[model samples]
Target: MAVELQKKGNFYMGEAPGMMEMGISNKNLDDDGRAKRTGTLITASAHIITAVIGSGVLSLAWAIAQLGWVAGPSVLIAFSGITYFTSTLLADCYRSPDPVTGKRNYTYMDVVRAHLGGIKIQLCGLAQYVNLVGITIGYTITASISMAAVKRSNCFHTHGHHTKCNVADYPFIIIFASIQIVLSQIPNFHKLSWLSILAAVMSFAYSSIGLGLSVAKVAEGSGDVRTSLTGVLVGVDVTGTEKVWKTFQAIGDIAFAYAYSTVLIEIQDTLKSSPPENKVMKKASFIGVSTTTLFYVLCGCVGYAAFGNNAPGNFLTGFGFYEPFWLIDFANVCIAIHLIGAYQVFCQPVYGFVEKWCNHRWPENGFISTEYAINIPAYGAYNINFFRVVWRTVYVIVTAVVAMIFPFFNDFLGLLGAASFWPLTVYFPIEMYIAQAKIPRFSFTWTWLKILSWACLVVSIVAAAGSVQGLATDVKAYKPFKTQGHE
Candidate 1:
């Protein structure tokens, strides 16, 4: 008798007798001999939406208020166009040599390693993982703010609007962290489709709620709404320097909102290979980016029209919409739910990277490489790894603690967006595309791409500086772990 073997990661397992007769065959598997990926355009779009339409949307009104009527919409549109274009380029890089028929690149770092190896791989990993970590921390802070807002909203309704419904954010941060710790145990990106779908729905719910509330406020003509062609007035609304810094920060906010590119390759990897992953991913990117841009413009413009220069950093949680307390609470709850899924979508890659490294470095170690199957009621047998459990829990805790320390939502978002926008979103994609396409140096196409990359780099620098300045100013008044929310 002959033995049949199946490869699983770096190890091999003996095939059960008559497995082929039991309807398990290579025909049902992908080219890589793994389970065939069933993800389609819709799932990819859902993942993109879940990743893109996160806490960043809450800060748009404030961003638009800083830029005003003209530049606000214009900049938002510009980002949409740029992001969609660059995203198409990135989608093509999911395969090496020949995109349609070539071998697949499973991660963003893999894509980099294939096209532009050497130190570039390290640089790409650092930028990507660091941005992902920053985003998770931001999500933690934002989720806690929304949770606190829910409590504060009910308090305002029970009491009066003028009452100082001061709520400490620490408790909510712990609560959010606790939930993430549980959800983080769900393994990898392939298993998160259901969660992403639910989260995408939640994102739409909250974003629509914010947009509707803003439109209602505008129509009712209740607030002292103001409008300007050039945005906030220099002397009346802010100092000249303040205006400049805020304008740059506003750019960062918009840039951050459009930043799903960091995870493009990872998302693309989940798609079935039939129609070409690049083709499906490109279409998904268009749909996702377009949908989010529409929501962003409506929310940012209408919210600004309602609050003008006085727009809150977070319209829902910043007490911009105080009446209809239940609706406010519901919207905040939706935000919290959305962030929970968004956090996992961003953090899974980091988790995967570390776990892969550990497993490779200690292939023979049981602690790092072993998995135990545990049976649970209502849920079938599940594989558990002690190392994964420990590491992911610690990761969640660190992010929660950091969120408690610096909860300056707007400034922190601006900084993360600025620091990541150019390298991860703009620079790497262009460089990879150029290298893979073998475009002639100094040619028109190469020249324009280089120019665009450099221009975005400059934008990132200014935006980061402004965000740092804002953080410095905020830190002077903020005490770590003692921040209070007032409605």
Candidate 2:
């Protein structure tokens, strides 16, 4: 890769340090790595929780409810299975490079850069941006859904006002987004992890209430446990709609689970902090992926059960269900807060990129102060608001018209993400190991990664297909008054 280092340390896309080498390894890494800044495990766990529990999670019940009680459980098993394989393969890829560099370490960019070269290296960034930004958009929309749901029940009054929908909720979405954007630029954010914990706890409360209500409702009408057993014995599959993309949605869901590549670089950097041992890296992956899988399954089950019937939008209508508006109001507050944490982690790179650019591009004359500032300005950006207006306007035009011809948002989009990520996260790293092996054959692993890589490729394709299919078949929209589980 060609890097034109200007008088200042500024470099552009063409010559960014992201290019070259099998990975980005700074040999002079400190004894402590990137994670040295990390605090307690609760904080760490909180970070992971918020990052993974993105907007797609709102679809858990909405999607699972379509397949019935049985299908709800199926999603859990499927995601767990896919995540195990994907994570194991990814960990194995990292393990291959024995005596790996510390701190400044290899990244996803290097996997492609090593094998496919510069053009492909550039594409990796493109993939990262697409997956992450699309994810951001999806989060914003989900936040809107959550916000609108909360607002809805507050005004659910008067027989004549029943038809008056909450179209005015759009402004709230912009406001919620404004909150996220402002939080993104903050530094010294270890305390913000609590926001994720708050959301998770709120989600837990929501699931508990919904589950209790569904069970009580089922028991009251079914005439005892025997009837419940019988109901379980005769589960139905509503995913049998004529839509071809339903299968794709399932695939995409599976793919989305594997989108763990989003933080692969971070993981590697974390491992680099510890001793050069594969065990720690492998342990972290196993713990993270396994825990995440189980957590998803349990949460998905509770949500699906709460709905009992397949409906659309979110699994549970936060606002319209059960009693006081207090529950939903709290849920909205938690979602908004949790997303605040999520945006901060993801936006770091964007801010870092720009800062590095400005630092390097501008000459080290009397006009600059670069005392190793990490975080950019977090709040009070009048110019940014103006920029957002123009930006959103353009985004609407492009996304609605030109982007329509391309695959923008759908069930298959997740699958597309999974498919691209399969290579970036699972296969490529292991394949790189095989390519660079010192001894052509090493015990059983050399042969294993080879087989595993192909298997990973297969699963990615299948999961992506399933994600697309699931998305197409799973067409439940968020309505305030619908009962009978999500379908």
Best by lDDT: 1
Q: How many residue-pair clashes does candidate 2 contain?
A: 44
lDDT, candidate 2, 1-487, per-residue tens: 2222222232221122222222435554234322232333444444455566554455554445434456555655755565555554454444324435422334455445554465766777677656656555545545555566566545553322344444444555567656764555343233355565675565445444444544554545532212111112223423234223443454455456435555544444433344443445555555555665655565555554544443333544433244445655565556655555565555444433434445466535323212221233663322122222333344433322322222223353465556565666656566555554542675587777677667767766765766655444444443332221222
Candidate no. 1 TM-score? 0.95
Q: What's model 2's TM-score?
A: 0.67
The collision pairs in model 1 are 68-231
- Model 1 Cα lDDT, one tens digit per residue, 1-487: 2222221253211111133343668777677655568899999999999999998899999999999899999999988998999999999898998999988888899999999999999999999999999999999989999998998889889998888887889999999999999999987788889999999999999999999999988889954777798888999989999999999989998999988887888889889988999999999999999999999999999999988888888899989989899999999999999999999999989888898777667766777666666777898766677778999999999999998888889898999999999998899899999999999999999999999999989989999999999989888877564444411
> Residue 344 of model 1: what lDDT?
92
Model 2 misplaced regions, further than 4 Å? 1-36, 39-41, 66-75, 88-103, 110-119, 157-164, 187-244, 267-284, 306-313, 318-324, 354-421, 433-487
Predict model 2's lDDT versus the native. Answer: 0.47
